[model samples]
Target: MECGIFHTPYMRPGRTDKETFEYSMMLAKAADSFGYRDFMVGEHGMQAWENIPNPELLIVAAAQVTERMRFAPMAHIVPLHNPSSLAVQVGYTSQLLQDRYFLGVGAGSWENEAVLRGQPGDLSEAHPRLLEGLEVMDKVWRRQPFTHEGQFYKAAWLEAGIEAGSVDHHDAFDLKDGEEYHALADHSPYGGADGLEIAITGLSAGSPSHVLAGQRGWTPVSFYGGSTLLRSQWDVYSAAVEARGDVPDGSRFKVARDVFVAKTDEEAKEQAKNGALGHAWSKYLMPVYKKYRILQGFIDDADVKVDINDVDLDYLADHVWLCGSPETVMAKIERTFEQTGFRYGQIAVNTHDALDDPAPWVESLRLFATEVVANIEVAGSKSPVHEFA
Candidate 1:
């Protein structure tokens, strides 16, 4: 599969926001230069670990520096903003990037974020609100005069026009009527005469959002879950798409995984255990996974019966993470594909803090992009391997 980078970027403690953003830019530049397909960043309003509140700003900046890498908000929480406003902003972003942007939407998952945004901490209405918001955004992007009276939002778009010489309108160029002047007449996506490419993140097994993605024919992005969870998600999504008389394509599916590569397997394991990846897991991700009881997926995927408490860095290195030498990592990737029967188009590398020592992190990304990727035969497989057959 083609490679990509997914930056949730759990920055180390005491890092300034500027430093964090610059670090992300560094990774973006590296990924672009390394020939990655896309770069995605998570959007979070309150969490310091996942600190980017507006991923669009980063995407815009990265677009300037990168040549061909596409960008997306690993997801923009749909329940937090006015759908029309977000639609317009995303449309503009897509226009600025010129085919380098895709939209990823989700309901706010964190209760604290929901509470901070003046909603119930339980987020009871978040899913329903997300559904309505997505519908409103779709309508808004159609560029038709329409009104929406939904459960969580009320919005309308009225068509407005400007005549060539009406109401003392100043034509800066003073061009003839037949001359083409590129104006923001349509706020739809750039080259979105068809439709904007939308993706949805699915974390938990059998997530309904993934089902929605299948029904809408949007990309289904699976978080760094183990093979079992990935298979479950694909099964759910494929079933949904099949029910709707659509064939599920694996190329539209993205799978995120924590990856680290070194000269040797032992070195990679040690670095992953003691370096930024380890720090992120020990300090940030593990805690959240424990709180949300997300560690069971790993536990279930392991060969031996392991308690959630025992799911440490070593356990992860052996079972969940794709950390090793290039050869080992490639084998792991191929194994995952063989097990799941789905060759994902994009292998989104789950990135962590590289502030402490950027060399190893950068090197790992380089090896994965250059060596491992070059060695893989199924890098561009668009369909499920033997699944449909």
Candidate 2:
């Protein structure tokens, strides 16, 4: 139960970016004061709730203000990035942050990033495109040259370079109409440099992508938005890993989800029930999350609609989120462990309009970490784990 802070800098109707930045800074500074172990930020280009549209820049700002916190993206849309270039920037950031770097990458949702800029949001055609992009990035960081020829993308006779204390964007682009769209290189070390871990949020362990990676011995950062929903998903994934004849030593799976913790059972429910987060539910995730729920083993069909109003704060507060007073929050968290068997309870505590109230959010983080985390035992494991046993 390693409690941490997750921020989604939302632009509430009345606030300016400067005001928002000021408030977000307050939250980060508070996380520092409160002695939190990690602070993660997210990236989304179009949503109002997604203010830190570029989490890497935000990470630098957070690192400058805080003394120590393992910083990462809840995940980045890796497929959209030039992997070689991503490697350099992340490597520099990781070194600058002095090894407190934990990089989380995802193929991502919302193909609309390119769509909004007069392009297409078709990951159906882009994932394989970006997958090869990552290959070039992997080799380039190790001072190697690699060529690529894959559907939707290609690179030939290329190399990239890195320098001490700076990110020099080397041979790192496949330009179309004078705009660099992807990477062309011989070798890429996007996740290998600095011992960075590669993680994937998937449909399940038995899903071809997850199982394929597992078969080749890549430990994935397995994610589930809710615990109960993923219990069966984890079972399937872990079983696939074990059955693959190449399961990694220890459980190399991480269950990362959004969680909120509070002091009193009553307060916890109120904190999470409806205002900011439920607003978020209404705005973004609920509309799209249902399909994944079914794909992840929760429901048979994907008619996903969550009436935010219908969500019982108390039931969800106690059951899903690690929320309650110190005594109660701790108890629920322990129960979460017993039930989920997940070592990593990655808590994305921040939500819609939440960062706007910097002071209280920070205080809640401190209360959860000091009061609840101190009383609990960290389920011991290094690999991202899916199930409890």
**Highest TM-score scorer:** 1
Over the stretch 247-354, how does candidate 1's per-residue lDDT look in tens digits? Answer: 888777788888999999999999999998898998888877777656777677667768888787898887778899999999888877877788777788888887
lDDT, candidate 2, equals 0.55
Best by lDDT: 1
Per-model TM-score on C-alpha atoms: 0.89, 0.72
* Candidate 2 per-residue C-alpha lDDT over 1-389 given as tens digits, one digit per residue, 9 for 90 to 100: 44455565545655666666666667777766665555667666766556666787878887888776667775666666766567677667766675666666656666677666444666564456446666665655665556766654454434433322244655444435765333443223334553665545454434444554455444454445545544554555566667876443323554444455565667666766654554555556554555455322322211343443344434345444455677876665555555566644344355446654444445566776566555555544321111111
After superposition, the stretches of candidate 2 with alpha carbons farther than 4 Å from their true spots are 9-16, 117-122, 156-194, 202-223, 232-254, 282-285, 294-309, 312-315, 341-348, 381-389
Model 1 scores worst on lDDT over the 10 consecutive residues at 380-389
- Candidate 2, residue 328: Cα displacement in angstroms equals 2.3
TM-score of 1: 0.89
